[model samples]
Target: MPVTQSDIALAHHLADAAGAVIRGYFRQPAGLEIKEDRSPVTLADREAEAAMRRLIEAERSGDGIVGEEYGTKDGVTNRRWVLDPIDGTHSFTAGRAIFGTLIALVEDGWPVLGVIDQPVQRERWIGVAGRPTTFNGTPVRTRACPQLEGAVMATTSPHYFGEDAALRYLALTAATSGGHNRMTPIYGGDCYNYGLLASGQIDLVCESGLKLHDFAALVPVAEGAGGRMCDWNGDPLTTDSDGHVLAIGDPARVDDVLEALHRVHD
Candidate 1:
C-alpha cells in the first residue's frame, strides 16, 4: 500500500516532540528510578512517552498503542502505533548520545511505517512499507554482502547472551568463515543498528533480550531496505518472540548465520 502523507507528517511530529523531551534532559543531571524489572528509568522516558501517547490519542484516537513505558491501550486495530519512548535509558542516564526514540505503525501485525530518531545524533531513519528506507531524508539501501564470511555483524549486548555470550558470539563469527566481525557498544542502538543495516553500512545485527517495541519499528525498515529480520530460529518477529532479533542484509547470509548459531547452541 502507498504510504500516506499524513502518516509521514504524524511520524515527523512524534519524533520532534519526543526529541524535545529527551533533549531537555540530555545533559542535565537527573534522578534515576528503578522499575520493577530493575531497568533504570528517568523523567525523560516517562515524559516523552506521555507526550507521545497524548499526541497519538489526540491525533489518532481510534488507533491502538503499544508502548514500552506505558504498556498497551485498546485492542488491535487496522493501525497500531508501537513506541519505545527512550530506547537507551541507560545511556540517557549516563549522559551519553547514543540513545534514540522508536516509533512504528503496524497494520494487521505488519509494520507499514517506522521511524528511528536519534535526538543527540540528530539523525532520523524512516521506512514505509513498499517504499525505500531513508536516513534523514535520503534513500538508503542494505549492503551487498553476499557471503556471511564477508559480513560485519553487531549485537546489542553480549550480556544478554550471558557472561560467556561474547565468547560464543566470537566463535559464531569465526565460524562464519566469511568476513571480519566486530562488536560495538551502543546505547539505544538496537533499532538504530537496523537503521544502519538498512543503510548498508552494517551487514547484520543479532540481539536478544528485546521487547516488541524494541524490534517492531525495525522490521519494516530492514525489510524495506532489502534485508531480512527475524528471530534466531528464523521465525518472523512478533510481539511474542523471545526478543531475539537477527537482521541481515541478505537472507542467505542470515540463514547461514542462524544455522551455525543454532547448531552450536543446540
Candidate 2:
C-alpha cells in the first residue's frame, strides 16, 4: 500500500521525538561507549532510537522496525520503520552539528517514505515516493552538473571502503579531480550528504558498507529531488542491496560516475 498523509505525519512525529531525546544529551558527556566494530555510541543514540520506537509502536503497532542501537522487531504488515537515531555518533559526541537522525519507512523491502532530521540545526528533509523532496517544508530539486568531472562529491570516510573497494573509490576521486575545480572528495558527510544533494548543495555521494538503515532513507530523498540513488554497479537499492551506494544529483552523470567507480587503478 502507498504511504498515507497519516504516515507522513507520524514520520515527522518520530523525528520530533527522537530529536527531543537527542537534544537532551548532545555534547553534555553523552556517556559514550565503543561498540564491537570500534565505532562509538552514546546515550543520545540509544535513547533517541528508543524514543522513536516507542512512538512507532504507539501509532502503528503493525509496522516492523529496523534500528541501529536495538535490533529488528518483526511486525504483521509489510511496512517497516528503519531508524538510525544518530548518523554520526562520533561527530555528535564531539559537539559537531553534522550528525542527524535518520528514519525511513520501507514497505515490502523498498523505501516509500524518508525523513532526515537535524534537530540541532532545525533542518528537516522529507521525501516520499512519487513526491518532491522538501527541506523544512519547501520543495527542493537537485542541481544539474555537466558531467562527473570537477563535480563536488562527499563520503563519510575512506575507512568505510575495504582494500579493494578503496582503490575503486580512489579511481572515482581521480576522475572527478580534473578540470578547473580540481576537486577531491569531501571527507565527512554521513546522512547530511544526501540532504545536501537533495537541496542542490552537492553533486554526488558514494560509499560502501552501508546497512539497510543507512541508505534506505537516502533513496527516496535523493530520487525525489530529481536525483538517482543506486548501488555502485547501477542497481536499484532494495533491502537486498549489497551496501555499495552512489547518489548523483544529475541523472545524466550516472554512467560517468559508475564508470569511474569501476575504473581499475594500478
Candidate 3:
C-alpha cells in the first residue's frame, strides 16, 4: 500500500516534538540513572519518549504503540508505531551528536513507513515500503558495491563485542581490506546508517545490543532503498532475535561479511 502524506506529516511532527524534548535537556546539568538493563537513562530519554507517545496517541488513536521508555499498549489496530525516543542515551549524556530519534509505522507486522530523525545533524530520512527512500525530501538509493573489498562499514560500538567476538569482527574487517570501519556510539544512528546505505554513503552496518524498536523501522528503509538488512547469520530479523543486525548495500557484500562472521564464530 502506498503511504499517505498524512503518515509522513504525522511522523515528521512526532520526530520534531521528540527532538525538542531531547534538546531541552541537552547540555544541562542533570543526574543520570541506570536502568535494570544497565543501560543509562536520562530525563531527556524518558521525557522525549513521553512526548512522542502523547503525540502518537492523540494523532493515531486507533494505532498501537511500542516505545523504549514505556511498555507496549496492546491495541486491535494493524498499524502500530514503534519508537525509540532517544536512540543514543549514552551519546546524548556524553554530549555527542550521533544520537537521534527512530520512528516507524508498521502495518500487519510490516513497516509501511519509516523515519529516522537526526536532530543534531538536522537531517531526516523517510522510507515507504515499495517506494523510494528519501533524505530531507530528496530521493536516495544505495550504492552498487557488491564486493567486500570496496565496502565501508559502520557500527555503534566496538566494546559491544567481547574479546573473542571483537577479534572475529576484526578478522572480517581485515578480509574486507579494512574499508573505513567506523565505531560511532550512536544508538539511533543504526537507522541513520541504513539511510546512508540507501544513499550510498555507507556500505555496511553491523551491530548488536538492539531491541525491536531499534531494527524494525530499519528493515523497510534499507530494503526499500535496494539494500538488505539481516542478522549476522544472514537470517531475517525478528522482534525476538538477539538484537544483532547486519545491513549492507549489496547482497553479495552482505553474504561475504556473513561468511566471514560465521568463520570467525566457528
Candidate that would win on TM-score: 2
Q: What ordering of candidates by TM-score runs from best to worst? A: 2, 1, 3
Error (Å) of candidate 1 at residue 30 is 2.9
Error of 3 at 217 (Å): 1.9
Candidate 2 runs further than 4 Å off: 179-182
lDDT of 2 by residue, 1-266 (tens): 98999999999999999999888888798888999988898889999999999999999999899999999999999999999999988789878888889999999999999998999988999999999999999999999999777798899999889998999988888888874444768878599989999999999998999999898988899999999999988989999999999999999999998888777843
lDDT of 1 by residue, 190-227 (tens): 56678788988888887777888888888878888898
Clashes of 3: 1
lDDT of each: 0.80, 0.91, 0.79
Query: Each prediction's Cα RMSD?
Result: 2.7, 1.4, 3.0
Better of 2 and 3 by lDDT: 2
Q: Which stretches of candidate 1 lie over 4 Å from their true place?
A: 1-3, 162-171, 176-188
Q: Residue 93 deviation, candidate 3, in Å?
A: 1.6
Residue 157 of model 3: what lDDT? Answer: 73
With candidate 2 superimposed using the best TM-score fit, by how many Å does residue 36's alpha carbon deviate from the native? 1.3
Error of 3 at 262 (Å): 0.9
At residue 142, candidate 3 shows an lDDT of 85
Q: TM-score for model 3? A: 0.88
TM for candidate 1 is 0.89
- Candidate 3 ranges beyond 4 A from true positions: 162-168, 178-191
